[model samples]
Target: MQTHFNSEYPSVEHLRAKAKSRMPAFAYEYLASGCFTEVNLARNTSDIRQVQLQPWYLRDFDGADQTTELFGETYDAPFGVAPVGLQGLMWPNSCQYLAQAAVDHNLQFTLSTVSTASIEDIGQITNGRFWFQLYHPAEEELRDKLLDRAWEAGCRTLVMLADTPTFAYRPKEIRNGLSIPPRMTLRNICQMMMSPAWAMGQLAAGKPEFQTMKNYIPKGLNMKHLGLFMNKTFSGRLTENKIAAIREKWKGNLVVKGVVNPADAEIAVKHGLDGLIVSNHGGRQLDRGQSTIVPMYKLVPEFGGKLKIMIDGGMYSGADIASCLACGADFTFMGRTPMLGVCALGKYGGHHTFEMLKKQLQQVMEQVGCSKVSKLREHLIAESVPV
Candidate 1:
């Protein structure tokens, strides 16, 4: 990978810009857009900026620590890659790229239910730094089988996304004529032709098929067929009862992702879940809903120690991770950064992306006079404005 801007391009925005140039327009939109209005998506970034960090100049800042522990495991950084569905649509073998990067960086990489690569494939790369996110399959037998496969793959944690009870209406996908497995219409062909690099990657990867769900479905299933299978196989609505059932099924570190409200966080605690990723599905679920930061102060304390509280959404810089920790997040998840890394650098991109975030977080910590990542709360200051 040739250097684009050699001062390290420390910010995720720079990496994203490079990624957008390499990727197709629909791929960029798929990773960037939110639901209707996109207010929540905007707020996720703006709200983080609102929280001010207090710097202690008198203290001697010798070294910086960016490590944190969650779910009985200590991660080298406070950030991990969040699960993204249809990642192959963005770039070929995205799940594998992200997982391998997470392993190289000593961070957790979550694989989505609808990811193109299978758990076994990703496990081979990172030796199972992979966390599987479930969509709550309609068929109990099939869902259990997938869980068993994840266990066999050495997955220690299970993340059940609680927010996406109903899939939000993404206008971009509809307008782009996008469906699962992807249809190559005139519009899509032009989009692909615009980015020969991504098109060639797809060609090499054999047309971006979903290996994760291939075994469950019949042979000769195309995008339209897979889309219909997804619609029929997984029920979006996940109730408390269903969660309880899941708790009974899986004993390992169970995480309830997509929590925005404090009450729902309490429900997760009551259900004996190990952790909660406070997020608005990265603004993909409810556009009008509040950003994850808006409810962090309220929800973190509500279930911080009893259950680890993490966040994801609108995080494009290391300062964003600092802001999340200062506000209330125990750990943060990088949804697009690692993908952007792979997009920009291919096999080694994920490693570079993780290093960039780690460097940024270290700089922020040293500047704020923090020695350990856990001491981030010591420097936290709630402004009259918002952080």
Candidate 2:
């Protein structure tokens, strides 16, 4: 395989196109679709496009610094990969591939609760460069047990997902029949036949399984039943007491994910969370919720220097990242974009995505007359009309 993407496909759209060609219709739909209507999904990127950069020219020529330090560790890039579930379904051993890429790039990679690989497995592969994302189970004992497993696996950071009270109504998944432990329907089989390379990879890896939940779920449940089981096993409810309980339980740096409101930011600080990610679940959860960047633009200033503000949503190009920095995010996290790159290009996906984003950022930095990413704020000019 060439293991390269087309020039036109530099952004996540490239991988998405490749993924659609490679994955079954059901699988592709599961990964690509957002909740009802996908209005918010489109809004995420559109909202980012609204912000224009004010570039300056003819400044002293010095290299820029993209390295960012958070909770004592320095990452070569300002952004890291956010967690996504069932990555192997998109591409075989996708979790391992992504984790290794993050390690090689000196970036953070978070493993989801329903991830195809175990935390320990990814921990070994990523060499502790991995973080763990938790889906709060209804049973306190089970929830605590899962957290303990993450800690025992040497995961240094814990990201508690707070947005999912119930699974969002993703129309594509329903129409595609994306149940747990996927079934090979005629529709799916036809779709899979279109992409021989992707089919071969899955055949080579055997079949994808939720490695983390293997110990928890009963072995008899099929894919259709798996979705229902997940619905029952996880609780979507997020409460202040739960946050306090988790903070008390996890000794490492704890970050609350899916924050869109400044009031929630204050509550996170009140709960003593180490960091907060301003996200609308990448516009996958609430269709009417404000775009992640808009809230981040407003909330970061409100929280000011007291809290570490991170943004995750609609970031594609390095220019998008620079825009986030210019707006006020201390660091950014990308979920779908990097995964799309990896699944599309295999081993080199991480390299290409990082280079792509870094190149864009460096160019923006040079043009904007900013020597450091922290100084990007001076270039921000809020638009009177959202682009």
**What TM-score does model 2 achieve against the real structure?**
0.94
For candidate 2, list the clashing residue pairs, or say none. 165-236, 180-223, 181-223
Q: Which residue runs does candidate 2 get wrong by more than 4 Å?
A: 1-9, 225-227, 384-387
- Cα misplacement distance, residue 89 of candidate 1 (Å): 1.6
Compose the digit string of candidate 2's lDDT tens values, residues 1-387.
Answer: 223334666767676787677667776667677899998988988888788777777667577888888888899879888888888887787788878778877887889998899988987887776789898888999988988888888887899888887777887777777765566678877887887877898899878888998888887766662346668788877889889999999999999888888788889989888888888887778998888788876677778687788888888888889888888889898878887887778767776787677777888888778888888887888762252
State candidate 1's TM-score.
0.94
* RMSD vs true structure, all candidates: 2.4, 2.4
Off by over 4 Å in 1: 1-8, 222-229, 384-387
278 Cα displacement, candidate 2 (Å): 1.0
